[model samples]
Target: MKVSMQISFNLDIINKCVCHKCPVQNQSECVRTQMAGLKTSFREIPLNPHKIPKAYCLNGKSVCKGIDRSKPCICGSCEIYAKHQLSEAEPGGFYCIEGKSA
Candidate 1:
């Protein structure tokens, strides 16, 4: 049987997220802008899911549409994915396109 858990939207999850490195988001200027924002004021501002470049699995659908869905998801390689048993979640890996895990 598959097991799953609710993912928390937190800095820890953000730190471990691999979505920033995903090929899907590699060409997205919007994602890049958000990454810059994250680097500068991640802790200063309350994190909004719409503003996060990565960790869409814990957050929700991405705000950027430039991401290419043809690429493979690297969630299987993320530390948070392993720790949270995200493989068992519905919609599995493409959280950017399929929305958050559940």
Candidate 2:
């Protein structure tokens, strides 16, 4: 049997996101833009559906090409990781590269 689950997105999770500190995010324009956008609003703004940041676990795969996989991931320490129990999902973690959790 196959089960499908929906992931929720919210400001609280984004606020506590550790992606900004992840090694994969170094000097990424995407991350920089997202950071700037977040500062201007507390709510998720889809001014450009293609520009939303964080919540890779919910937003699907990242399109950014500058990400470096050599860096260690900090998703395990994120509050969203524990709250969503993402470790149990297939293709877990590394949402930036592998996309959202299954």
Taking all chains together, each candidate's TM-score versus the true structure is 0.87, 0.76
* Model 2 poorest 10 in a row by lDDT: 41-50
Once fitted onto the true fold, the runs of candidate 1 whose alpha carbons sit more than 4 angstroms away are: 2-4
Clashing pairs for model 1 are none
What would the per-residue lDDT of candidate 2 be over residues 1-102, giving only the tens digit for each residue? 222337556666667778878878766877777667765645445434245557787777777767778888889999878776788885677888887777
In candidate 1, how many Å is residue 18 off? 1.1
Give candidates' CA RMSD values in order.
1.7, 2.8
Question: lDDT score, residue 18, model 1?
Answer: 82
Q: Report the Cα lDDT for residue 22, model 2.
A: 82
Candidate 1 — what's its lDDT?
0.81
